[model samples]
Target: MRIGVIGGGAIGLLLASLLKQTGYSPVLYVRTEAQKNEINEKGILYLPGEITSYVYAEHIKDLSQMDIYFICVKQHDICSVNSRLSGLSGTVIYLQNGMGHVDMLHNMTEEQTIVLGTCEHGAKKRDQRTVIHTGKGKINLALYNGNAALLTRYKEVLNDKRFPVEQVADWGIMLIDKLMINIVINPITALFQVKNGELLTNTHLHKLAKVVCSEACAVLEVNEQQQWKRITYIIEQTKENDSSMKEDIALGRQSEVEGILGYVLKKTSHQSSVIHFLYLSIKALEEKRG
Candidate 1:
């Protein structure tokens, strides 16, 4: 199967490398000239573990020829890049950070086949061509537009390779669960300028994470209309690693606090004033840092 990977950052490049490693020859399509030069010049170096070796890709080409496309750009760029990628017939995988990216991409694709993919396969770029796998969380997949054939093909690859894949019927819950994790873990870590684990050392940080998670859980319980989410479990998952947002802030990169905390605060009508406070505080923190 021909897979197309968009964005050459950690997530996109990692997924593309995994697919290619497991007998699926995939083409990687990146946006920037710098990224293109990096991928072409050095190729992708994926290290799943300390002992794992690097894998180079052969089908590096344009975006249209892909049978499955992985969209892994930052949240703000989702709409613009997806708009440019309007005419693809393949299933698109959203592997970026933050929540609401699928909705933005949905607006661009018009009910097009999309994959709501999640991975805690923690990756950080060692260099432009190399990425280091920091943690091992299973990859989850959900079908949005309802293509059974595409879903089957997706599961087949993931399952055969022993990659964790779940075809969630109601991905909004998954989105909420992820949002809960991102909301708490991301901001506190960013605000404190600490690793994900460092938040635990501060009693107030732990309380703050709980507060953010609680707010997110409340919003999810009402808005997405689901209860299967594990809010506490989500918060605890990234207690050790540095959150993507925290890392972004430390590196002077923009974050998705707007998409994660701001979305729930603005879109969902919650009566709790504490939720509003938490949301606003996080928003201000991100802006000040940005």
Candidate 2:
């Protein structure tokens, strides 16, 4: 199968490496020619054992042919590539972090199959050609506007022991669950400049996280207690790993705060003080870093 993995970020490199390890020569579509050339020349360096996998690397605009395309870009950057993705004949799976990109899928061609997914794996791009797999996690996928059979077929083709893939019945619930996790973990970690485990180790941060989680659950109409348990469990699993928002702040790149907390603000009629505070806090950080 001709699999096209979009973006050269941590998630894209990790997915490309997994496909290569699974015996598929996946084409990795990066934003810059420099990244494409560098990856093409050096191949993808998957860390923790120093395994390298050689795969096809092409510029994002050069994306034309592929049986399946995995959109691994950030939610905020989805607009830049949505036009090209909407016209593809093959299946396009969006593996973005938040629910912000869901609206763009409505404009895709009727004939094209669209899949939405939430990634839980902790990945960090060490360099253009190096991706460190920090923690193992499953990818939850749901059909947004696609054939049900395609989900079953791709689940078999893409599933592996190292990188597992699971199917979900409802895309809304799948994304909401991921957003809930992000809303609690991301802003606190970014603001405090700490790892995922620090939320648990530091009592003060843990209390703040619970408050943010409760506000998010209230807006999304989900159970706060149940979601807090899940959030704590995720923090435990990815204790040593850095949250994506933290990395973005450290690197001075625009984070997905708008997609996470900003989305919550838009959903509710009543004001969410905690959520509003976090939403503005991250935006302020972005400006300061810029």
Candidate 3:
């Protein structure tokens, strides 16, 4: 099967490279001509310093044709990109952070299949056309079509040795859990301009993180896992790399706090919810920076 990648960011490139290894044809589209030139020269380059094998492929600047489209843009940019890729009738896999943005994309194009995906794998752009593999994790998929076979077919693209995928019902709720994972950690790291591991030493802040995590669980319906469960691994991962939000804030760009934290408050209605604080605090923090 052929796949069209709508972004050349770390996650988008990684997914394209992985699909290339799995015997599927993939094309990567970027927003800029500079990135397009850089990627075409480097092809599908991945530094798998921490992981096993990586697949490599070339990027296409001009859109040709495709069977599937993977929308890997930031949560805020999905609307604009979907507007451009309106002709493709293929499935669009959203490898974005947080939840609830899918509905906005659906409004843009109804004929296309919008697949929701969460990547546990950590990737950071080292430079134009270069991305470093900071960590490894499975990708969970939620497809719009009710057909389990389509889910299975999507999984086949990532079913290889390096990147296994899991399919689940209620992809929106699944993304809620992923949003919780990003919210507490990404913003704190960005605001502090510190690595996650370094922030863990601050007991008060660490406790605050747990508090937000608890609020997110309540909002997203994720049962509490444990103190040293999945979070511990992330704490260690944060030691080496700054978070995505950290990178965004360091570069003076806006954060996805709305998609990550604000999504919870918006969905919960804040009528009788503790997560209302998260929304207020994050907004206040962003406003102060302004």
Per-model TM-score, in order, reads 0.84, 0.97, 0.83
lDDT of 1 by residue, 2-57 (tens): 76767667777776666656766666666666766666666677785433223333
Best by lDDT: 2
What value does the lDDT take at residue 179 in candidate 1?
A: 71
Among all windows of ten consecutive residues in candidate 3, which has the lowest summed lDDT? Answer: 50-59
Query: What lDDT does model 3 reach?
Result: 0.69
Kindly list the per-residue Cα lDDT of model 3 for residues 1-290, writing each as its tens digit: 77787777778877776676566766777877777766666566677643322333333436656666777778888777766666756666778887757667646455456678888888887676666777777788887653457667768755767777888788866776677668777777776677888657888768777776777777666776752256656777657777887787676566677788777777676555435655565566667666
How far residue 242's Cα lies from its native spot in candidate 1, in Å, is 0.8
* TM-score order of candidates, top first: 2, 1, 3
User: What are the root-mean-square deviations of the candidates from the true structure over C-alphas?
Assistant: 3.6, 1.1, 3.7
Candidate 1 has which clashing residue pairs, if any?
A: 196-239, 196-241, 197-239, 197-240
Scored against the true structure, residue 62 in model 3 reaches a CA lDDT of 61
* Model 1 whole-model lDDT (C-alpha atoms): 0.66
Model 1 quality (TM-score): 0.84
Residue 26 error for model 3, in Å?
A: 1.8
